[model samples]
Target: MASFRKRGCTCEKKKCTCGAKWEYRIKYVDRQTGKTKEKSKGGFTSKKEAQLAAAEEELKINQFGFAENGNEVVLNYFSEWLEVFKKPNVKPITYSVQERNVRLNILPRWGKYRLKDITRTEYQKWINELRDHYSEGTVRRIHSIFSSAIHDAVHEFHIIRENPIQKIKIPKDVENTNRVQYFSKEQLEKFLNSLKTPQKNAKYKHSIQYYVLFSLMARTGIRIGEALALTWDDFNEKEKSISITKTLVYPLNSTPYISTPKSLKSVRIVKLDEQTVKLLKKHKINQNEVILRYKNYKASKDNVMFHQHDGRWLRTNVVREYFKEVCKRTDLPVLSPHALRHSHAVHLLEAGANIKYVSERLGHASTKVTADTYLHITEKIENEALELYSQYIKF
Candidate 1:
């Protein structure tokens, strides 16, 4: 319904109304493909401004033409397109992660370019450059963003004829660079003993709680975030089980947020051994004492199992720092909080726990992942089969 009409503009510098006038118009058209396109033209006081406005109008026309009627698309328009198209469809944690990757890695490189203009060769070159600078995992994640955005552009928006990154190959799986760590029984005892060292300083009396957190992680194999998201209600003293239904995640530049488990299987109930149950009972008593001592202050409803002395949820990074400190104090190898989960799995497998039980305990989607990840522990099973074969053979 846009009508094209020209309007005159007077210029003070020219001192002539007719000679210095500029024309402005708006036009709408239906393309042969049945797509509606709108174009606008505007005059400015200066010729430079007029040219800039004309170029802007031309870009708008191109953007409109790329999509069908009532459709709009702009690739790598990070703020606009991501908010309108991607954010609503994904979980908060996923949306936050995508936003971070787009802002930090993808957008800085590709934001200015249109989807149709980015060729596979150019994307390949960009990925190669990233490979030289970033880790393989980081490069792969960035490529995922590009692929997802371009795929949406092609299929949903009809903005591009094809996805240029459709055939681009990602690198083969690289061995995880992260060090594999498992606690020796002796080392774990030594670390726990170190945590029991009484703090002479009255300000830091919750050191034992730190030990409790470590022990829980080492015994339960729950993710640090999942542990942090636990509340009093999630635990069942009578049933002797802990329900893992939510996880706490902090994306870059975002506040800590609660998200559902990574998969349906991740929502699980893990039985607590008597020792772990006793530890939890003691932890509850300790938490109550701390709450009484700090009754003057308010606390959040989340009331995480572990908290700062001030009663705030313990930040994940802060926990990592404390872990490092504990290792240093105990003269142990540096280990991440997640290493405790791995240690738990390895120890359980070494104790002759079956693969199915291990998988269920770890809340894995299937037993295959548990078996694959812990293939080292299955060596005994293999040896048993070999021994059976040897018994049948008489040479």
Candidate 2:
């Protein structure tokens, strides 16, 4: 609560302009610290002006924890939000995305507005304007970052009652969002064959590294980062299971680092078949032979399964470019490295594999994610399961 008080002079050295001196004084408990404090400001022309100022002061203190009279600007608060909330707690890659999104998208649109001034109607209009300029996915990402920051501003800073963004509907064009494509068995084989076949002016006699990398992606439906992160130690030849605990994150122009896999579900032991084990064993033997051919080139102790010529960890971009060249050589469908993973999922589902087991094998956080991704295969698999179940139920 706040009150208007008359700032009467002491009648000593200062002039006795008691009638002209009125001050707004607020005595309130700090919401965060739970401590009592008093704030006062003098030089108001009259008691009525002081009273109005005192009321505004009281409202600010009670609601948004405003100590003085200024509103927080969006850019200033977002920077503070990152330093206080995002930077300290989030993963490096996660922070990188947050920082980049804010700098590129959110800052341009909403940064100039004060927190209190950006209303739901104007923000909604801004979002609708984005659909024509940006894809649904990009717009959704921009909104997600903005909404998350506003969430913090309310909870941590007490800047607003609720996130106004929560009331807005996200523009989700389902057809645009789900563009993941996969290849058939024949197409995949043709793509793989193109890799092993010798190309003009290539330094290596055969594409052993490219073949192994693509095979790994096909066999295990793991993300490229997870596959690249594999070490010799991760594969248990005896058990035929590989431990997937880490992922290689090679951000553009930044030093590569290892991070915990995409999610808790991704940190799993994925079983490998005997044929794959044999292929891997062959690749390792060939890799070592290549290393020995170089002058004084002892095989690197890094133990990374897929490596560069010097046995260092391979960058993802190098692998992507290599894959692109291999695709150009073949008549098979031109697909990204990630298409190998999608192909694995689609093939398993088409072959009457259980959705639950497939979900676990693919390291999906939930079966719903697997079902959602491979929606085309759901009914066919379910029908196959029903027929198989009928044979067992002898009633």
Candidate 3:
């Protein structure tokens, strides 16, 4: 309900000659916070005008749950939206990624600005600024998170009329495209061999588990997280396959936990080669001997295939550091553990495997995604296909 009053007049005592404008104040309970808030406008010429304006205000409140008043800060609204919508819907790791980017990128710049005041020109400028400091991929993700929140504000909350960040183009990355993200077959073989062959006078010895882990990743192209989440039950010896149902979500700053795979397709089964199966079988026997050697040692209750000596999920950071060291020792290009996945994809394509088969084997969402990611990496395969096409054509 709204109350109308005359302002700039001494009407409480008696009617005066001074002119005053009519005002109407509507009080509404905010559904998001469960608190009453007031919306008022003054300077109307008459009480009838005030009442008509108040009706519009009341309609917006009733329809949209609250009237924005165009003064709400972006940071406050985004925080509320993140909690109410995104937190429950996304995975913990995904939520953390969104929250971290919002804190580090979005809030630092536009948090103080009112949602109604942010124009498209300003948003595009901010996106360009972000592109200057971060990789195109990183900026794209940050932009996506921010734009998604804005979209929900317009469509779901009616806080804004439209999203200003729509149709914004992400700037190209400045980083070198030629920087190696994966390895050739020979380099992959060398890296794996370094893991298996014992190093003399080494500060720390490489274990058989590390060898099997890399071997599995190279052979099957499973994610590092999926490989870490593997347990004895996930493997089938007779079938020569591994079920990729879950993945490890190990944040660098927090304790590790098991989560579902990256997507629905990521939960599919991955067939293993004979050599990888033999490596895993050998690793299991070695793990059993190690367990017997230490009576007080506590093995991970889940029986994870690759774990710390005390039987805990291995940290990806630690694995990555060791992987880099192995690369340095063997004179190979140091790349992240994910490179094994890329190498596996490239190897399959080079061996004349069907694109659809490789896509399914790698658990990609589609063959297009597979081709887009690995097509550039398979230059040799492309040349060979071109050669074959030229030979067959006669015109």
Instruction: State which candidate has the highest lDDT.
Output: 3
What's model 2's lDDT at 149? 83
C-alpha lDDT of candidate 2 relative to the true structure: 0.79
Q: Candidate 3: lDDT over CA atoms? A: 0.84
* Full-model lDDT for every candidate: 0.72, 0.79, 0.84
Per-residue lDDT tens digits for candidate 3, residues 343-387, read: 898888888898899999888999888877875756667788889
Cα TM-score per model: 0.74, 0.78, 0.82
Question: What overall lDDT, based on C-alpha atoms, would model 1 receive against the true structure?
Answer: 0.72
Please give the ranking of all candidate structures by TM-score, highest first, separated by commas.
3, 2, 1
Stretches of candidate 3 off by over 4 Å are: 1-26, 29-67, 174-180, 199-206, 294-297, 377-383, 392-395
TM-score-wise, the better of 2 and 3 is 3
Per-residue lDDT over 1-395 for candidate 1, one digit per residue giving the tens place of the 0 to 100 score = 32332355355563556644344443545333354445445555555566566666555544533433323323324465578777889898778778888888887777666555678898888888887778777888888876887676677555566777877865543665433466776777787678777556635574357878888888889989888888878889999989999988866566777889878999999898999889888988877776666654334466677776666677888889888888887899888888788788888887878889989988889999887776765766678768989999968
Among the numbered candidates, top TM-score falls to 3
- State the lDDT of candidate 2 residue by residue for 86-139, as single tens digits: 898988888888888898878888787778777888889889888878888788
Please list the Cα RMSD from the true structure of every candidate, rounded to 1 decimal place: 11.3, 8.1, 6.7
Question: Which candidate, 2 or 3, has the higher lDDT?
Answer: 3
Query: What stretches of model 1 exceed 4 Å from their correct place?
Result: 1-78, 172-187, 198-202, 292-303, 379-395
The number of clashing residue pairs in each candidate reads: 0, 0, 0
